[model samples]
Target: MRKHKIAVVPGDGVGPEVIAAGLEVLQAVAAADGGFAVESESFDWGSDRYRRLGRMMPEDGVETLRGFDAIYFGAVGDPEIPDHITLWELRLAICQGLDQYANVRPTRLLPGMQGPLRPELGEQIDWVIVRENSEGEYAGVGGRVHAGLPLETGIDVAVFTREGVARICRFACELARSRPRKRLTVVTKSNAQRHGMVFWDAVCREVLADFPDLDVDFKLVDAMAARMVTHPGDIDTVVATNLHADVLSDLASALTGSLGNGATANINPNAGVPSMFEPIHGSAFDITGKGIANPVGAFWTGAMMLEHLGEDAAAERLMKAVERVTENGPRTPDMGGQAGSADVTKAVLAAL
Candidate 1:
């Protein structure tokens, strides 16, 4: 049997709760399949660890995680720690360290779920957001010179390179080609941001040449937002910068049904290193101990992890089970039901 080593980092708040539910589903699937095995190592790294060690993780955390086949990451935020510090310290550190450049978020309206959009829209709003993960606005390029003074000014430079832009656009195009529509929408603000944004448009155009059959178009970031809501069916694959895609994908998730159903994969398509899979809904602090935190996102993330690990049948089976449960009944409160995390997880396993 093929055994895959997985590093589990249940970050904070509802992270551990939802991750536990996901693992249960994963275990159930593996037991039923009998084709492969998953050996996971859980790491106590997050806000609590930061409070004790003055850092989110040990200095060698990245080195330790490098050996895993994939990283199954839960949400990473706490009330005590600053958001930027927590994000940069753990999540960003791992992504940059591993060179996982493409952040892929797939949004679709699951069965029996009512999205903010009209119920008639249904699954027509399906979209895959290809975010330029490694660089762009999130790059820690600038700093503050003067602190706590009227003259203090901070600069956060947006880094855009030809290689970065081209590779991401190519990835999006290939993804678009794989879909039925073969359509791609490139998001940029070139008219305003001359240097970085304009360069992004140029690189995307250069990359489009390689895929002659693709039906590609460009839109300003602001206009793209309206189009996503107004005409989601017109878009199949979307490519954008880090910050733009981050915000857009959240909007995409909300339109599908709930943020609790969104999952993301930080992939290094070349397979040179391990990729990271996570639920983008974040740690819902208000529902941390309420046992009402949704586990659909984490379950979907686990399916993505299995897919990345070359377990295609297992991944598809897990997702079909989730859809079956969602279509039937007994959903979490986020999906307008009275079920708790464990209840939904049990329903999914039973469906499996």
Candidate 2:
């Protein structure tokens, strides 16, 4: 049997709850499928760790996670802490340090979850948003206030590099080719951020030329947002920059239902750095211990991790089970049901 070592970081807020449920689902799948198993090592690494140690993960944190086959991450965010501090300290640290530069966030409507698409458009809404993870507007090239007291100004430079843009676009194109529809939509704001976005569009054009068979198109960020609401079926795949993709993907997920149904994978396939997979939603601290937080995002993210580990069959099975449970209409409070996260998790497990 092949054993895969997975680094598990159950992050903060309801992250641990969802992680527990997701691990349970993964275990169930392993029991049902032979010849493969997962060994997960829990890591106490997040905001709380930062508060105590006065830093995010240890300096050796990236190296510590290097040996794992993959990392199963729960959401990371706490109202009590400064968002950027924790984000850069942990999430962004692992990403840039480990060279996990391509973030693939998939937005698909679950069975009972409603979408902006009409009934005639399609039954299942599946789309992937490929984000340039390392550098873009998120590159952190800016200055804060107090530097010029008279001006009292702050500056944020939206940086974009050819290497970063080209790699992520190529990844998106490759992914599009494998999907049912060979289509890729490049989203940008060349109309506004001329230099940076124009560079991104040029990179997309260059990459699209390599994949001649794929149908490629570009949309301004604003139009893309509107179309996503009114014409989602028109899009099959989307690739965008860090900040733009971040906003659009969250909007896409919300269009399908709540933001809790999306999962993302931060990958650096060449480095052997274990990819980090997690739900796209933030930590819902309000529902922290209420048991009302949705675990669909976590479980679905686990499925993505399964596929990344080369267990596509198990991943598909888990997804089908999720679809079944949702179709049966046993939804969590966010989805307009009384069932808690545990109830939905068990229903999914039973279906599996």
Candidate 3:
């Protein structure tokens, strides 16, 4: 049996609660199968810890995380802390330092999960949004030229490299091949930013030549958004630059269900380094301790982590159990049900 060590960072607010649910699911699946052993260690590195320790995580945090098989992360944000300080110190630090460059978010609606989308647009939405994690718009290369001055100026440069663009495009293509639909769409604004967008388009064209069997297409970000609203079924796999991907994935998540139920996986496939998994939603400080937060997103994220770690059996079982739970319709308030976080989590465990 393989024994995998998992580092659990039960971040701020409902992070702790949902992580508890995910851990419960892990233990339940392990107990039933007896095929693997998972040893987990908890870390206190979130907004609350930040408030007391004056740092999001320890100085040697990446070193500690490197020792584990994978890091099961919860959301990180606080009303009291500045957004930059909170995000940079915690989530972004792990992503950049660990080089988890493939932000793979599968946007699929759970059976009972409902959102504010038009009723008719509900049933026909399922797709994966693959974002180039490392470079491009999120590179953080540029900064403010002046602060607290009459004429304050700030600039953020989008950095795109051949390696970065090619890798994510390939990842998206591979994902599309696995799905029922074998179509891959590359999103960019080559009409505007000639250099950067053209470079992205060139890489997409180069990558597509390698995957000759797959159907390929490209669309501008603005027109793609309109198409997503009208004909989401036309899209099978979407690969885009960081900033464009950021907006489109959120839209994709909304189309499936509430933002609270969206899941994300940040991966570095070359090294043996494990991926980081979390929900798309931020810390809900307003409803933190009220027990009203949804745990579906974090639980499904655990399913994705299990799949990535080569625990295919466990991952499939957990996902089926979640689908069963969702199909039964014991949803939380965010999805239009009155159940609390623990209630929905317990229901999922029961189904498992």
Q: Top model by lDDT, which number?
A: 1
Q: For model 2, how does the per-residue alpha-carbon lDDT over 1-352 read when each residue is reduced to its tens digit?
A: 8888999988888888889899999989887887689899998888889889888678898899999999998878888789998799888988888889888988777777775567554354578888889988899899888775887888889878888888889899999999989999999889988798888898889888999989988999999988887777889889988888889888878877777778889999785679999988787888989998888898889899999989999999999998898889578887878999889988988998
TM-score of each: 0.98, 0.96, 0.96
- Give the per-residue Cα lDDT of candidate 2 at 105: 85
Q: Per-residue lDDT tens digits of candidate 3, residues 1-352? A: 8887899998987888888888988888887779887789999998888879999999999888998989899889888899889888988899999898889888876786665567566666787889988889889898886699988988988999998899989888898888887888899999999999999999889989988888889999999999888886787788888889889989888887677788999988866686799988878877888888888888889888888888999988988888887778677777777888888888888888
- Of candidate 1, the 10-residue stretch with the lowest lDDT total is 116-125
Candidate No. with top TM-score: 1
lDDT of each candidate versus the true structure:
0.92, 0.86, 0.86
Deviation from native of the Cα of residue 102 in model 3, angstroms: 0.5
Q: What TM-score does model 1 achieve against the real structure? A: 0.98
Q: Over the stretch 1-352, how does candidate 1's per-residue lDDT look in tens digits?
A: 9999999999998999999999889988999899999899999999999999899999999999889999999999998899998999999999999989999999999998988887756567889999999999998899997799999999999999899999999989999999999999999999999999999999999999999999989999999999888887788899999999999999999997789999999998866488999999898899999999889999999999999899999999999999998889788888989999889998999999
lDDT score, residue 297, model 1? Answer: 96
Show model 1 residue runs off by greater than 4 Å.
none
Cα TM-score of candidate 3: 0.96
Q: Which ranges in model 2 have alpha carbons more than 4 Å from their true place? A: 116-124, 145-148
TM-score for candidate 2:
0.96
